[model samples]
Target: MKVGVVDYDAGNLKSVQTALAYLGADQFVSADPEELLSADRLVFPGVGDASSAMRVLRSRGLDAVIREFVSRGDPVLGICLGSQIVLERSEEGNVDCLGIVPGASVRFPKERGLKVPHMGWNQVSYQAGHSLFRGIPQGTSFYFVHSYYTQPLRADLVLCESEYGEKFCCGLIAGNLAATQFHPEKSGEYGLKLLSNFLYWDPERNL
Candidate 1:
């Protein structure tokens, strides 16, 4: 199936594209609204400042395209910064976001005594029977590099949780949309498996 990787001038496009290529996915990277809407599925991956990212997405009208894609009930996978900006707002830039999922991205508390970025591999505890985690063992470790974590307004939207200084939502799933705070592209075998699962995931049957 053709997969569209949203490109809004954020980082990590190459890695995500490379991973999808390894999976033999028919994919293209574009910010063009029509191109994105034509794909079977969409991968929204990013790494950078949230405000600047939103600025680029809005400038290119990708923000609306993304919402439109989701509204059409097409599958959308969000990663890292891509995951954060899908929420209603982000504390990083104190800016509004796409709001595909009802939530807010907030910075990790410094009072918790952990490093700001919470970099490196961390285990993710996910709910069973979800297609996104299909074939993947529970509590699998995934690569993460971010200071902000998503707090989905609906607890049921959380598909996985991880611990740094404290437990935080690491993955979210709502209908046709699924997102992860961790980078599956950088997480080796398990990471690749996750992407492969996403490729075949049927939101109707899986969600």
Candidate 2:
């Protein structure tokens, strides 16, 4: 299926594109509103600061475009900072997000005694499995490098949670949209499998 990797100034577009290519997806790098709307699936992959990313999004009117696509029932997958963009708001810089899901992004609490970045490979315990998680071996470890985490207000939206000093939402799904705080590209075979599942999954039939 055709996948549109949103080409934003703050996102890691190339890395994402490489993984999608490996997954054998029909891929295109675009920030064009029409291209995004026409995409079979959309992936927002980003690194770096939240506020700055939002600024770049707002400057080019991507925020409105993304919100529009979500409204139209497009399947979306956001990674890392990209996932934060889907939250209602972020405490990172009091920045507003796409608001496609009910949640607030917050920085990792220092009191937890965990490293701020939470880098390295960590075991991802799957709370539940669906087409998106198909082929993922049990107790799979994925790469994560982020300080902020999303706390979705809707418990039902949370598909999985990962432990880092405490349990936090690592993966969340709402309707046709899915997002992960961890970078699937950096996550090796399991991560690549996740992308492949997204590539073939049909949200309507529940795959």
Candidate 3:
């Protein structure tokens, strides 16, 4: 299947491309709306600030493009900053987001020696019978580097949780959309497996 890696000027396009390549998937990187909408699947991977990323997405009209794709029952995966932007809003820039899912992004607190940007490896616990967890064990450690985390209004949308000072939504699934707060592309072996599952998963059928 053909995968589309979004290039809205904020995604980690190269590394994502490399990971997909290793998975032997046909993928392309593009900022053009037509090119992205034409793919079978889409990966929105980003590393920059949330507001800046949203701005680029809007400039390219990718926000509407993404929402439309998901509305059509296609699968889309958002990573890192990409994860935050899919929610209703973000505290990073105090800006509204795509709202494809009901949630708000908030920054990690510094109280009790808790770091602002939670960086490093942390174990993720998934909901029972989650397709995204296929071929992957629970409590798998994934690489994370972010200050903001998404708190989806509907708890059912949350597929996985990871702890920092407290628990946070590390993975979310809604209809045909999926997202992760961690950098799966940089998370090593299990990460690759997760991406492979994503490549072949039909969210509608799985649900």
Q: Candidate 2, residues 6-120: lDDT per residue as tens digits? A: 8778856898999998878889988787777788788888988888998888887778777776777777888889888788999999998878899899999888677889998
When summed lDDT is taken over every stretch of 10 residues in candidate 3, the lowest stretch is 198-207
Question: Between which residue pairs do clashes occur in model 2?
Answer: none
- What lDDT tens digits, residue by residue, belong to model 1 across residues 94-174? 999988889999999998778889999999999788888888888889999999999999889998999997799998888
Whole-model Cα lDDT per candidate?
0.93, 0.83, 0.90
Candidate 2 stretches with Cα past 4 Å from truth are none
Q: CA lDDT of 105 in candidate 1?
A: 98
If candidate 3 were superposed on the true structure by all CA atoms, what would the RMSD be? 1.0
> Residue 3, candidate 3: how far off, in angstroms?
0.5
- Give candidate 3 misplaced runs (Cα > 4 Å): none
Tell me how far the alpha carbon of residue 112 in candidate 1 is from the true structure, in angstroms, after superposition: 1.7
Q: How many residue pairs clash in each candidate at the backbone level?
A: 0, 0, 0
lDDT of 3: 0.90
In the range 1-207, model 3's lDDT, one tens digit per residue, is 789999988945899999999999999999999988899999999998888888989999899789987989888999998888899999997999999889999999877598767999999999887887797898999999999999999999998999998899998889889999998899999999889889988786783
Q: Rank by lDDT, descending? A: 1, 3, 2
lDDT preference between candidates 2 and 3, better one: 3
For candidate 2, the per-residue lDDT at 111 reads 85
